[model samples]
Target: MPDTLRLVTFNIAHGRGLSLYQKFSSPERIRKNLRAIGELMVKVDADIVAMQEVDEDSHWNWNINLLKEIQAVAGYEYAELGVNNRRTGKRPLAYGNAILSRHRLEHWHTQSFGEATLGEKGFLYAEIDYKGQVVPLLNAHLDFRSRKRRVEQVESIMDYIIENAHRGPDERPLAPIICGDFNSRSKPQADAVNHLFQHILKHREYHLYPRDKRTFPAHLPSKTIDFVFLPEPYRMTRCEVLPGFLSDHKPVLLEFEL
Candidate 1:
């Protein structure tokens, strides 16, 4: 059954538009949340866009390149940027996590993950084709005040994508789609699941938040921690949590059936 794609995951908190603050130091609230993140990606037409806290200032010279101005206000003609903080003083402090595509990006990769409690956490891999089939996208950002450091950075990003699994492209049949901003969607019962943290329990595999609800207060999102995952045989028709207001998480959409 392969043919259905509509994905989105956001953490535009560093477009600094209207100031979600990540040290842009405020220029009239980064000119109103960088124009409310280009009207929140054109009201979420997202066919693929997993972003999180982006910035690129080698040293605060500021030329305003908030990920090409939110992909030219959500026009997304295919993009990729996964720097995960690269500061070099006089003008080279880059931020990270961004993977966009209206389908056509054929290869990409980036690493840098950790039990990292709060700084550089990245993973933005891509290899899309969309209109003609072929997929595998991941853009993540986890580590919000430790849960065993988000279980060793989600088990070192699923053991580095299951031990490289052929480095993607060439035959592309993985069809994975793991989105972002998962500050651990609530699981503090302690119990005995930390068997060094394996992850495969959120409804036994993957299919998150809709009944699990909540996506971090855009005004009142109790707490869902933003996510979207699908692998093996692809199949998820609706996964929502998008009311939106600029940040503090509120963007997740998936359709996938590919």
Candidate 2:
């Protein structure tokens, strides 16, 4: 049987929902939000889930590892967390991206972008064995403030992908898929979103899925910032924006077959 995988990319906003400040101050609110987020994850039921803005041992979030919490309820056997932002204060803070899967995740690696005033942002790279084939995956979260910063980050990502594409067959990534909260709204006026899209197409030969879906502001989404890109030989059978307020950004669910 051909392998079909259900993938989801979500920015859980540290599981704080809309009450960001309050959720950090009040433990009860954090607990409530986490419970709701776990329920949402189970409902999604993705085979491999990539998350951005996830918390890892942060004091504000009651020092709870948000990815582990979600993995418990989502029934994923393997999970990897990369802390991209770190603070060395009395009450330390760390934020990053994560990947959770039912299959073993190997070759775990992470890349951080150039320094930005807001904070450090990066992507998680790993490989998984699916139906005896090695599949490469990248989960990324780009800068949300400036388009120039996002363009730089995207260029870094593209360089990495292009470099790996030329490696020998024994070392190259097989049928790679990149997905995440790009934070660059889709527009036609030569913006960061289009720049990143064209860069991937030109070098990596990857195509975006569900061209019309909007995936931000989970309550009333109007921006198409999140995306999933895959190369040929991998067919996206279904792609849709899942409706929920589990986080500030709506979760994007993609089903692909190989």
Candidate 3:
């Protein structure tokens, strides 16, 4: 039986604005960027795509219903958009995380992970009903200002899963397959993703449990920050970084078997 899943996570940087290296704000340039992102996702062929920084506001065309547009380009029917930047003033912007799936969804919830209101972050928790079983997939984007804040967000996420995974009202939580843009850029944060692996193989309960890890500089990824954390039951088949595209950060894909 083909009982495997391909999941992808990328902080598409939505309408945040151009990089410091980019000075001129050209529509063609932005469209090119979006097109670039869409093309990459099409090739990845992930069963589920979790994207951050997608625009849902109307201030700029770059922010115009980006999740939907991208989905249309990728040809995925099922999708979920969790709006983190709620409407505040004439600028009713709502760019958060998005989860796209080809499988039938059993349950869905939009979760916030920011400890404070610095730069709000969210996660798209979804249950994929494949072959008569439920598998939970989480797509998240953590804060980037401080390491402490990011670590707190990670802790909250882990706690939420372990405590409330199987307690959703309308859906059953099979297992959490977490993947996203975790802006932790240090040794402490990098090792935190492998908590159970470290415990089992390295014989330690935890290492680098409270540190920030960075996953930027995809072409020359010096520090591993982005991740697709597979728990005990889930097995990782492949992991790779797709860098230097539309988004400031690189896109990551994880192939695994359920």
TM-score of each: 0.31, 0.90, 0.79
In candidate 2, stretches whose alpha carbon ends up further than 4 angstroms from where it belongs are: 22-25, 115-118, 165-175
Q: What is the lDDT of residue 173 in candidate 3?
A: 42
What candidate 1 gets wrong by more than 4 Å, as runs, is 1-8, 11-17, 20-50, 53-81, 84-87, 98-108, 111-123, 126-136, 139-172, 178-232, 247-250, 255-258
Q: What is the full ranking by TM-score, best candidate first?
A: 2, 3, 1
- For 20-76, candidate 2 gives per-residue lDDT tens digits of 553454666766776776677677678888999888877777777888877776677
Local accuracy of candidate 3 as per-residue lDDT tens digits, 53-153 = 77676454534677777777788888888877665565455668888888888788887764332258878788887777677778878777766666666
Give the better candidate number (1 or 2) by lDDT.
2
Best by TM-score: 2
lDDT of each: 0.66, 0.78, 0.65
Model 3, position 213, has a per-residue lDDT of 33
| Clashing pairs for predicted structure model 3, backbone only | 184-212, 184-213, 184-214, 185-212, 185-213, 185-214, 186-213, 214-225, 215-225
State the displacement of the C-alpha of residue 217, model 2, in Å, after optimal TM-score superposition.
1.1
Comparison by TM-score, 1 against 3, better one: 3
- In TM-score terms, candidate 1 sits at 0.31
